[model samples]
Target: MNGPTILLVDEPTSALDHERGAAIIELITALTHERATATILVTHDRTHLTAADQIVEIHDGRLHLPAPAC
Candidate 1:
């Protein structure tokens, strides 16, 4: 691919508590943006998506892309 480097993270905070989980996602999102890395974070917790540029979700076996800009 000729796009920016993309990192795919699946459920990076499924096991941790709410606080720690938010921290982890925040860190990943911050680093990704600071380095211009295109990150694809697959998460179920919508609250932890503060750092994402756009949020995409899979619903009914399809991709939903109504996420707001960051």
Candidate 2:
């Protein structure tokens, strides 16, 4: 759980109910901070976006990022 760890969790909350989902997310976030591990979470849920340090959205095999204003 520590020392150069990488956690690749896919749809971790997909099967959980709302309360459980939130709790799981909180636990994972806390573990990331406590263990200082690199966590890569993959999901289609936008609600978890705010918890991420960086957001990379992929659509139609392409990645999207915020574009500069004209």
Candidate 3:
């Protein structure tokens, strides 16, 4: 794979089924870790965000970040 410092993915799994979507997420996660690449995943589906290191949401043209875990 080409060495990239960052990867931006937009709705990569939107057209896929649940299983395929999961596989894509896993692949992205693995690549992010293995390559030490920063990944930006934009998706409407909130089901698979567990793989993210940080999660943010945009609402009413505002950016909202979640509170850190206790």
Candidate 4:
């Protein structure tokens, strides 16, 4: 009733500077939890993994299922 509950973000900060990029990630994670929505963020930036409930990595052209957080 509020809005779309699922968010898919692919390289949402690809064109931004590091500071702005981090801010964007922070906003995204906050909104995801605040709205109780599912967010699928596909990015090469592994630093944002802490915000994810599950993480899948692509290795050798295959998707490796969610691995234990490092």
Q: TM-score, each model?
A: 0.78, 0.80, 0.91, 0.78
Give candidate 3 regions above 4 Å deviation: none
How many angstroms is residue 44 displaced in model 1 relative to the true structure, after the best TM-score fit?
1.0
Writing each residue's lDDT as its tens digit, candidate 2 over 1-70 gives 3366888889999988878988888888888888888899989877767778767778999989867559
Model 4: per-residue Cα lDDT over 1-70, one tens digit each: 5677899999987888878888999999899999989998999877667767888888899988965658
lDDT per residue as tens, model 1, 1-70: 5456888899999999999998898799787877787888888877777777777778999988895559
For candidate 4, list the clashing residue pairs, or say none.
none
For model 2, the local distance difference test gives 0.83
- Tens digits of per-residue lDDT, candidate 3, 39-66, equal 9999999989998999999999999989
For candidate 3, the TM-score is 0.91
lDDT comparison, 1 vs 3, better candidate: 3
Residue 31 of candidate 3: its Cα lDDT? 93
TM-score: which is higher, 3 or 4?
3
Pairs that clash in candidate 3: none
lDDT ranking of the models: 3, 4, 2, 1
User: Top TM-score: which candidate number?
Assistant: 3
lDDT against the true structure, per candidate, is 0.82, 0.83, 0.94, 0.85
What stretches of model 4 exceed 4 Å from their correct place? 68-70
